[model samples]
Target: MPYLTTADGAEIFYKDWGTGQPIIFSHGWPLNSDAWDVEMKLAADNGFRAIAHDRRGHGRSTSTYTGNDMDTYAADLAALVDALNLTDIILVGHSTGGGEVVRFAAQHGAGRVVKIATAGAVPPVMVKSDTNPEGTPIEVFDSIRAGVLADRSQFYQDLSAQFFGTNREGSTISQGQRDQFWRQGMQVGLAAAYDCVKAFSETDFTEDLKALDVPIFIAQGADDQIVPIDDAAMKSINLVKNGTLKVYPGAPHGIAGSYQQELDKDLLEFWLS
Candidate 1:
């Protein structure tokens, strides 16, 4: 229920729990702080401060139509960290949230942050271009936009099913997980979600990855349909100066949710190392 007012006056909702080393989490597109619930609790229970915030226009945050881009997202995160005067932070991000964390490190993190981690993240670039020919086609993202404009609810439901690999063969997901995904997606603003499709798909994080002087932990889903491994975390890992890359076999975009226990253990190890 806590909120932090951004420089632009947007009310950003955040959850801060426990105390000790701070681990800040940033959720993916159209999702809220709830996306990091499992990770946050795990970290908090282990004597770490876990914090996550709803990006503007998502979840309980103010639903502003403008500033749905990466810059604003990064700035909002930086503002939250500054407001709390948090230090020695371990910043973790998923998908678009990964983009937010890297951008924050490159632009504003500096002395305040200790390390960075991203899973199934969108970085370096997700849309194809001359430089990133392996990226997903712009047409694919266009379809996503059309889907959102058509039926946001159905679109989110379908995505939730695929996001966690529930639609894949030999896969099973709980009703609670499905409901959580749909619930988080439905909480986002329609306009903000629409604009964010472009923001996450097109924004380049090349410089951000290259600028990372601290140790970075990169996790990629080998079967991720949303952001392919080659174009995202894989390439991002190569750019970081002190990066450790891990590829989860058969994992989808929602690795943090689908493989929560493994991810929690890996993160704890990373924090200790």
Candidate 2:
């Protein structure tokens, strides 16, 4: 139940376990540090310190209505890292958290971070624009906003099916996974969560990806429905000076949960190598 107060006076709830090189986790949109439970345990058991923080508006953090954009999100992450005085960290982000990590690295991570890894992350950009033609259409995100404004609870519940790939043919999501996602979604502040949709979808990470000096590890699912590999991971790999790509065949957007074993193995290998 530890918390860190940001420069903006927002309290961020975080998890810190074990004692070794820190593997800091940033979770996706509308979810909290709880989403990284499996990865945190795995990293800790494997002889590393594991850390995860709820974003400014999600989980146990201060549910403020303002400062829900990428700049604020990245700044909040920077504040957490600074307050902890942690170094030699391996930053790992999933989905929207991926965007947060990259932005943090580009804007603040420099000397503190050793490497970076993202899975099914939203980077380079997720929403289509003049430059990002392959990105998901803006209308898709707009529709999401509409859904959130109309019926957020039902919207979050229904989105979990696709988010976890349960809606796919022959795919089955465990009740536990569904329940966890729903619970996390429901706990998020309505205004902050709604604002985060644009933060994750519209914020471009091209410069962030290009500015990264540390070795980059990109883990993505080939058939990811939420953030397609082609527009995201693929383009991201080419942008980084030192980058490696690993594609999980048929895996979904929630790879950290659905494909935890595979991701943990790969991440451990990268950390050791």
User: Per-model C-alpha lDDT, please?
Assistant: 0.90, 0.89
lDDT of 1 by residue, 1-273 (tens): 899999889999999999999999999988999889888898899899999999999999999999999999999998899899999989999999999999999999899889998998899899999988888999999999999999989998889877888888977677688788889999999889999999999999999899989999998778888888888877887899999999888888885455766777898888777
Error of 1 at 32 (Å): 0.4
RMSD of 2: 1.2
lDDT of 2 by residue, 1-273 (tens): 899988778999999999899999999987899999888898899999999999999999999989999999899888888888989989999999999999999989888888999999999899888888888998998898898789988898898888888887867668788778889988889888889999999999999999999999999988788998899999999999999999988788885454777888998899877
